[model samples]
Target: MLLSSLYIIGITAEAMTGALSAGRRKMDWFGVMLVASATAIGGGTVRDILLGHYPLGWVKHPEYLVITCIAGILTTGIAKWVIKFKGVFIRLDALGLIVFSIIGTRIALEMGLHPVICVVSALITGVFGGLLRDLMCRQTPLVLHEELYASISALSSILYLSLLNGDVTQTYATVITLTVGYLLRMAAVRFKWRLPNFHLESETSAH
Candidate 1:
């Protein structure tokens, strides 16, 4: 079930990014599909390598690629109609992040990894794919920008791991984690919330 959910979220996010980029960059259908597939699978591929999982999740399951391609094609068509609803894309992107974080953490825990590593891995698995996608398209990565972004994913992974350790049902824990992450992200977006920035002072600052 977890894997299925991850696959769905990955495909959707890839398609959405592709479609959005298509609209924004005036890319053709094939270009959009290529970008979408990369956006969807890049992080998972990295995660599998870091986790030392052979065959990789997506490689072992070719259906994920097919789904991503189909999603890209469908989203390309739908994006034209949905372009006016800008907020919808942000919400969907948040949802994808939430789902990916939960799935990544769960997989790490199942592999008997430490909580800290699991949390970090979860964040990487959730955000790096989108970061890679944005970089490839010459856009600023959202995870590095003025929003909670990766912090929310890290928080969700930590919270979910805590709940799991406390004997919570897997389903309940996942749902709660995803909800908390999504809400936190949406709130951050709506309220323009961001982490504090620090500036260093010069030794001779005061004259």
Candidate 2:
């Protein structure tokens, strides 16, 4: 029940962010919905396709799609507020990342996947939606940029799996993972902690 509620919140937050991106591009309503839906569920769709999981989440639960669409349209009316309180959005996004990661890990575990595959699934679920949102908006994918986004997802999944392996209760494990994951992401953002970049300078021609 907790996971389900968090999943809804995660999708709604993601949809709003996607809508904001579309607004920046001056896209139409249809474009807003498209980007919003992609940002909210694109990761799960990709993960299901790769894992050969039948009936994608949004497909099975059409209400999820409706929620994202509604959230996107609503965002259009409150874009200013969203932009004005960017920090709140960032925190929400961080929470969503952890929620998505936990969902992905649980699904893979139910499928009897290897731990490594489970981690990969979590990473894809947590990061791919934002990647799609950025790509559709003609922006660089945040996953490819200097951020600990994907790493945090993987770490959260690993922690969740580890707790389960240690014989922790599902509820407890989830709570612990969510708390740690959210803090890690927020700390990364606050400290500008990120993976190193590889910058190749242009060769200067000898005059």
Candidate 3:
């Protein structure tokens, strides 16, 4: 599966970043592996659980899980290099987000789920891994306050679905989605594009 191959790339890249995070916190080897696994597979796991999908990807192919763990360990030795080349990880993460979204959308579509559910699935797949990583590392959830992360995932899912619905070839739809999604994310990061955040200046309730 095209998505499966991209999924492996995404997990490997995500695991490297997660391992970098662990190093920043001075975590032990076990902590690096745990964070890496969660950051790489946590979103898909959450999405599967919510959609009641069985035989999770890692469960069906445990090698992928092992890959993430190994990636984490390797990062410990390459921590300085990883941190210095953080921009590379940013690009990988952008690509990973699109890959995860497309995969999630396709999964729900395969299950005959509603379009809305498919979009939600994409969102969960793209964002939850970062969310889980942040929670574990005691850092702020960047998705909530940073660039148009979740929105990009939603847009990619919807656009991909639209192309497919319009009878476009699966190959074209995937290629176009990957290109557009990747550029949009890079632009968002460059410009610091962010969704409007809600701020409360009062303690009063609507009641």
Candidate 4:
């Protein structure tokens, strides 16, 4: 249940960030709610569908849905406040990335899935929500081009799986993972760490 509590925090943080994105485009309240919900829960939904892990999060936990919507509406009133605290949202987003991955990894383990699938589940749960937000907003998906976004998610899977394998208690492991993941992600952002990008400047560059 510790993970569940952290999950709530993660989604609330994510929803605020999503609402800010919606406000950037001058969207209505309805649009804000829609984007907020998507950014908060969309990744988990996609992971559930991929793994056939039925009874999606928002459906089973309607309170979480309500929380996200309320977070969205509140963002509309405090848009300037949200923008001013953008750094805080980035930290929250990093925290959410790990929490979502850990939660996904646990579910996959419960389903008797392979470690590889568990990692995949973590990846899906971490980044698909942002992907959905970008698509809905008609903006380029940041996950695809940003500094170690999905890589951080995928890497957290390794730490989580390793911890579980080491006979660590789930609660302790979750906390440790959260601390390490949050630090790692924030470091990456602060350092501008990124993957090597591929670009083709020529029309006939490759075979």
List TM-score per model, in order. Answer: 0.87, 0.96, 0.95, 0.95
Per-residue lDDT value at 196 in model 4: 98
In model 4, where do residues sit more than 4 Å from their true spots? 205-207
| Residue lDDT tens for model 3, 1-207 | 777788889999989878878888899999999999999999999999999999898999999899999999999998889879989889989999999999999999999999999999999999999899998999998789998999999999999999999999999999999999999999999999999989986876776
In candidate 3, position 45 carries an lDDT of: 95
Candidate 2, which segments miss by more than 4 Å at Cα? 201-207
Please write out the lDDT profile of model 4 over residues 1-207, one tens digit for every residue: 778778998999989989988988889999999999999999999999999999997899899999999999998898898789888888888989999999889889999999999999999999999999999888999998988888888888889899989999888888898888889999999999999999867776557
State the number of backbone clashes in model 3: 0
In model 1, which regions exceed 4 Å deviation?
6-10, 198-207
Q: Which parts of model 3 are misplaced by more than 4 Å?
A: 202-207
**Every candidate's lDDT:** 0.79, 0.94, 0.93, 0.91
Return the number of clashes found in candidate 4.
0
* Candidate 1: clashing pairs of residues: none
lDDT value, residue 149 of candidate 1: 86
Residue-wise C-alpha lDDT for candidate 1, range 1-207, written one tens digit per residue = 874775587567656786577557777878777778777877777887889867887788888877877888888778766677778778888888888788778778888989888998888788888887787678888678768889988999999989988999888898788788889999999999998866577664676
TM-score of 3: 0.95
lDDT of 1: 0.79
